[model samples]
Target: MATKKKPSSDQGSSSSALDSSRWEVSCFWERRLQKELMSLMKEPPPGVTVDAEGAGQNLTQWIIQMDGAQGTLYEGEQFQLQFKFSPKYPFDSPEVTFIGPNIPVHPHVYSNGHICLSILTEDWSPALSVQSVCLSIVSMLSSCKEKKRPPDNSFYVKTCNKNPKKTKWWYHDDSV
Candidate 1:
């Protein structure tokens, strides 16, 4: 059973107070994701577009469309990014991965669509938004001078968890 109440009035709900603990978690992330989605649609970052329809129906999952930046090794290529948010997002980071038929051949992106970006893992911050993440991904791709998979992409993909966020990412100072 579920009851609906304004987030501002969460504490005032007639429902069990014990449920408030769980309610608050969803409220926090829901509010943050709504704002982030609105801002992304209104003023999306360079070479990026949002799948507004997918977001409207399901706040937990989003499909982001990105165009490879000009002059980059992936120039003129297209890619889709899938962002899956947990109830503790903002405090935690979303599970982001490349999802379409045209996944880019980047050293950080495995053939299984998992990305090895630090912000998506150990270095995530509550201050970061979808726009900033998109920009970071764009920057990563734009700065790349060649198209190649990570040195350990095969081994990692073969034995890694389906959820990219679950893996302990080991970023090196020498990586792209």
Candidate 2:
């Protein structure tokens, strides 16, 4: 996790649980994010691509595009993903959401673009990368036989925090 400090005379400030204070993404983490970005650009997995220019200029935010995997329920469909990193990235999971025009309609996905994927929250680990997150999303969509929204879509979408990471998510089923 990122080190936290009260408002200070410093070079960087980041949003955290406490709105009154800010956190800093240390140089070590910046270099690590950069390295991961490079590796992803060089050899990304199938149906996944990142906006390198965006990622380079702003390490804390990224826009990713993922095409639905072949032979899957969502084949040929395109979806856009947005990832917002806090100072605690890799330690605190990124605020990931399906953005843009075509959000997939899987049971775990709300119309508001929030996805109910465990890895994006409770199951996240420092070992997971942006590439791995995309893969998991694709796998989630690929495994679905029905194209529908979550059962609580209406209520949740209306009440959830703009950042999906802020939600107290309850993951009941992995078999979806």
Candidate 3:
């Protein structure tokens, strides 16, 4: 027997807010993302580069390029991460995933591009920023010893939620 999870009161209200003022809310987040993008362009972190995808008119989605850090199993390898931000950003974490043809095979990373990192889910805080998330991901890659998938890779990839942010991930392993 399985138990059903209850939706939080906050979720309900946020959904209502979205339904009521969808355009206004999206504009607010877009401006915020634009500001962050400008700041990032001025001073980006090492081994990480970000740009708006498509015609650069939308700030809601971005493409991030990351180079594997030295001394890691993925050294010299490059990867692309796609981040999709919702109108409730800062309050809601972005949907981040490895994109393109070269996805890294890491224990916490799914073949479908979903990453099981805690910060992107349960551990997410409104205080966390895009820059911080990039740093965290780079650090995760840096600490990995072996290039491989999680123990339940095949199963998880087959049945995992399309939106990783909706999944309830178990993050017991912190060894990376």
Candidate 4:
């Protein structure tokens, strides 16, 4: 009689891990997010234009240009938004922030160019896309009840961490 060998636990675990990783790489959320971002390059938001400045021949990093929506405080302003996607994206949200001089000195946006948004922070979900982020920012700029910063804007700006991903922001208002 020939003896049959059973697969070891280590081998099974490794195989399962690989499969999970492969599945993550091909996840529906990632595909949807990428598709959405790509579509924006072709047909952008109203009055907004985005150009991809390839970060070393890879599409991981993008410098997006958004022409502030009309009837907004940012009207006539062309803002630069930086988007950096990780390999484990959709699971880990992209690192997005305003870059360079075009950044608006708003209540929600810090002087260092970090944006304060719920979705970018504690409220992030795999369902959200780059288009949604942009739309949210546009809406943010559009609904400026006043030109001044929020009452706690100074403290938030000073104490806030430079890395948007690491910072946890509280979302108090959904109206804007």
Scored by lDDT, the top model is 1
lDDT of each: 0.84, 0.82, 0.78, 0.69
1-176 per-residue lDDT for model 4 (tens digits): 12243333332113345344443433443344445556786777775556643532455676778887777777788888888887667767889999988778677777677887888867778788777888888888888766666667668778977778887677777777
Instruction: Please say which candidate is ahead in lDDT: 1 or 3.
Output: 1
Residue runs of model 4 more than 4 Å from their true location after superposition = 1-34, 53-56
lDDT of 3 by residue, 16-110 (tens): 45455434432455545655776677688998888744414566788889998887888899999998888788778999999999899888898
The better candidate by TM-score, 2 or 4, is: 2
Candidate numbers, best lDDT first, in rank order: 1, 2, 3, 4
Residue clash pairs of candidate 1? none
TM-score of each: 0.84, 0.84, 0.81, 0.73
**Candidates sorted on TM-score, descending:** 1, 2, 3, 4
Query: Candidate 2: deviation at residue 109, Å?
Result: 0.9
Model 1 agreement with the true structure over 1-176: per-residue lDDT tens digits? 15563455453222244344555533767766877888899899989999988896898999999999988888899999999998889888999999979988988889999988999988899999899999999998888877899899889989999999889888884554
lDDT of 1: 0.84
Candidate 2 structure quality by residue, lDDT tens digits, 1-176: 34453344442422222233224333546645776787788899899899999988899899999999999889999999999887677788888999999989999999988999999899999999898888888889999998888999999998999989889999998695
Give candidate 2's TM-score. Answer: 0.84
Model 3 has a clash total of: 0
> Each candidate: RMSD to true structure?
6.5, 7.3, 9.3, 9.0
Q: Which pairs of residues collide in model 3?
A: none
